[model samples]
Target: MTKQPSSLTSIASIVASMTAVAIGNGMMLAYVPFALTRSDAPDWVPGAAVTMIAFGGLVGCVIAGPMIRRVGHARAFSCSMALVILSALAIALGMHPLVWVLARGLYGASGNTNFIIAQSWLNHASANHWRGKAMALFYMAYVIGLGTGAWLFGQIPADGNLPPLVTIFFTALALLPIGLTRLPTPPAPAKVSIDIPMVWRNSPVAFIGVLAAGGLSMVVQGFTPIYAAANNVSQGDVANLMFVMQFGLIAIQYPMGTLSDRIDRRLVLIGTCLLILVAGFLALSATFSNLILLMLVFALFAGAVETVYSIANAHANDRTDPADFVPLASTMLVAWSAAATVVPLMVTVLMPVFGPRTFIYAAMAVAALYALFVLARLRKRDEVPAAERESFELKSAQMPNAGALVEAEARAE
Candidate 1:
């Protein structure tokens, strides 16, 4: 009989895969719309293209669980990686707007499933005590990978086949670690179902918090570069801005995560939204005028925006049974992706008519509205007992169902 690889081995493999693909994925995110804008495509195309990626993500979340159940986790992961490579190649070979849109859609589906595979694997491997830190490390890996990719974007010329070719290299590199690792895949997932009402009942704050996170985060990630470009920021500095935002996110991750463990996570969620409002106001004031100041404030804004999903996840997990983790996560992702899908398109369509600062106004409105919702929720439910609360972990905002592995363990218990 084969010996099971230790959690340490699984973690190494998972983090390695996340880091590698994130570099590629990060580059792709910036490259797609930036490329569209540079090509003098219609203003709506860049945002429309971004919306397609989000739409693809919604499709990915719906399918990833069942795909893992059908093929088994390891095989499912391999399939997603294959798609990643193929999509990147398509993007490299063709710059036609239609081809670019289709390639990005493929990348979005496959890329999101890839992360879901890794996160579910990591959660399965980690002990309860260690899961928080392990997850935080995983989050850090992507942040660093993305930061590195954005920095490289500044240095590399966008012409020719070089950008997507480089993305393909990293996507290919991601496969090596997973292929060699002996770590076991999580027991196959059960059939997937998204029960949004169940999740809303589990934690109303989490339900709304995720929507707030998704809507604001998509705007930030999808449009920040385009917004920067519209305001006359240089291409290289735009890359630097992306890098700085990631740096800000990482710097606060540990502190915010640990604090969520100590206090009412709802309170933390409220504070985070407030931070977003303040940062949005600052960013609008800066209006891409002072690159240095904008970067500084945007970092704080990004940092606050990034933490909402994780804190809300922790809050929801506190109220939920481990047995329900899989479905609860699915529901949450659906909520997130639903918001993600519509919000960017709204900003994109309005930006040309209302001007570039539209994203700032929309993001601020989201944060403000969410904060008010949390305030109402706070008056309704008492805090979960401190002892029952799960320790917090940093989670990616894009993919929702990271808790599937926890369900198997819950069943075994």
Candidate 2:
């Protein structure tokens, strides 16, 4: 009886900590790009900064498993949080483009590593019977925190250093919960080898799908402020756009996952791609003049686009061996992070020549190409049977340890 209550308390502490950092990350997501657009930096600098962040995320994934093993979860989490605060302060104080790049890199590294620690700790502490519920709660924390932060971005007066300072405050707040928790630190996450080739061999669709999902979703979330700034959108409206789009991303996850569980997951991916294409068409076809309509289309688009990572991940796990689950998780995140790194650089080159609409155009091409590829593969491979398929969970590229948790749940069952 006591075990259950204690487990719940520990899980709650982890969630609180995760939510605080996510709020800070959400603010930085909007602030960085918008600030760059207003600065004298070249058009490509925003994309470059994002690319560096992705690069740092890859670094985080590599280091997290070992870092936790060496220092334990509580200490590792604190260290990562400290790095986040440092990065935020750097961004707050620095005006140079190179400084922004370095700060964003550290931000990405710490943010990704911190999430891995939080989720892993939550997984370790959760009672097996209700682990799924704990994970669901964890998912909600991220979405709520991120959305709240974006909304706060709009609410905060942009006067002087207030915006970045508020972000620093949230990052600082994250340190208190986990740092002070009475619960014991969870065991170190086991080191798993990541192999991209193995991922491709097991599920080509998942490989490509996560890549597309990561790239598309990252661009939509990370670069939208740049697009708005380019189009002369007010800061308040830009923040509103981010809030609405994030809401859409959160709203669509379960419905799509539930629907995917009922039928072929590929079909769901196809539908999501179509939504992306439709959103792109809407954006290009004079919808920008009407803010409400534009927001609706973007909301729809974000919901569909962001859901791709989880669906693709579930699709792969359906076909993967239990022994390989950890590796699969590691590999897919690598794929996701890699695409996130490369795609922004590619898009930025075009954005400079074609203006803001180039973002929409690049997204359309990715959607069209990914949809076609999935279609081609469908003819080559039959769908995994429903009985054998893993129940879909709402997932994000940020939560790199989710697949390992899924494996643990299966073992618990």
Candidate 3:
């Protein structure tokens, strides 16, 4: 019998696909609002448009598992990229606000499908000991792509269709590596129940952590600029704030993952949530004055909030049988998508009533609730011993494939 090559051999192509998706996402995040602002749309239009993307993501999460099973990862990813390209063209064509909302939603859904495919493939390919480091590299690539996309946004003129066109070009470029590479496809996942009650029973901290982190992440990415602007921060500075936040998110992944591997992951999760809560309150109270301090706070908030997702995922893995990873991960991704979809709309209502700082308040509330839940869970259940626990791997709800990879790995063992 011939020996097959390890999945790790395809790492380069996986990372490339991840990077492309991230860049496209980052570009859209910056471009959509800017384009809408120029269109003389009402204030709610931009936020609603961004929220539509999350809503699409929720829809994508529901379909991606089945889609990947039917078509294989490469083709599924290709389809996602095609959707992104078409959506970008639709936006560039100066569609009506309502049409743009639908287009953006398509972009969100397709982008999420790409994420699931890449992450699943990576998880399936990675050796056990190398999983954490592999995830770190994946995260680094994702963050760098986002930062680069934001930089591209600055270079492109917002006045014309150029931004979306450039986004389309990048989305197309992302397809190249996938099309050219001969990557192995994972088999169809086994049928397993994804009961929310079972997930919480297994790991409440992880369950709540995912929900809170989703809310925190969406608020920061979708509304931070608006929050800054309302506080009289300059537009350029708002861009800088997001850049610093992304840098913080990139910088923290490996260190946090390594730390979680060594100790109680719940402790790491709790500490990070506290930090995010503190940063959120500080940002709210100070009104984002003192540019340097504001950037630092934003960075801390972004880094901590983003890290929670991975920690929660790792924590959930600690509690579940290896075979259950796929269903558990899918459920968590759905939880994240639901939170991301609803939180912004909730904030939109709150902002008018509570003032522009409402986003910060929303973040703080999430952080506080998560922290409290973690503490309570600690009291109710003993920690998984470090010796017995799986090594912490930095994952995002963005990549739904990790679960499938974990299931495959379990079967191999």
Writing each residue's lDDT as its tens digit, candidate 2 over 1-413 gives 12333445557778888888878877888778878888899878988887788888878877877788898888988999889888888877866888998889998798778877777766666777667778878877887788778778888865456777888898889889887787656555677577777788889999899889878877777777888877878778878887788778677777988999999999999888898898888877744468888788788878888778889988998988877777888787777878887887788787778887776787888889999999999998899999999888777654544334222443433
Alpha carbon lDDT of each predicted model:
0.79, 0.79, 0.75
Q: Which runs of model 3 end up more than 4 angstroms from their true locations?
A: 1-9, 37-39, 191-193, 229-236, 253-256, 285-290, 397-411
TM-score of each: 0.93, 0.94, 0.91
Mind giving the per-residue lDDT tens digits that candidate 3 earns over 299-410? 8878887888888888888899876676787778788888988988898767668876777888888888888888877778888888888776655534433353234553
Off by over 4 Å in 2: 1-9, 398-413
- Cα distance off (Å), candidate 3, residue 126: 3.3
Backbone clash total for model 2 is 0
Instruction: List per-candidate RMSD values in Å.
Output: 2.1, 2.3, 2.6
Model 2 vs. true fold: TM:
0.94
Q: 286-396, model 1: which lDDT tens digit per residue?
A: 856578998989888888888888788888889988777777877777778778888988998898888877888999999899888998988899999889997776676
Candidate 3: 10-residue stretch with minimal lDDT: 397-406
Name the TM-score of candidate 1: 0.93
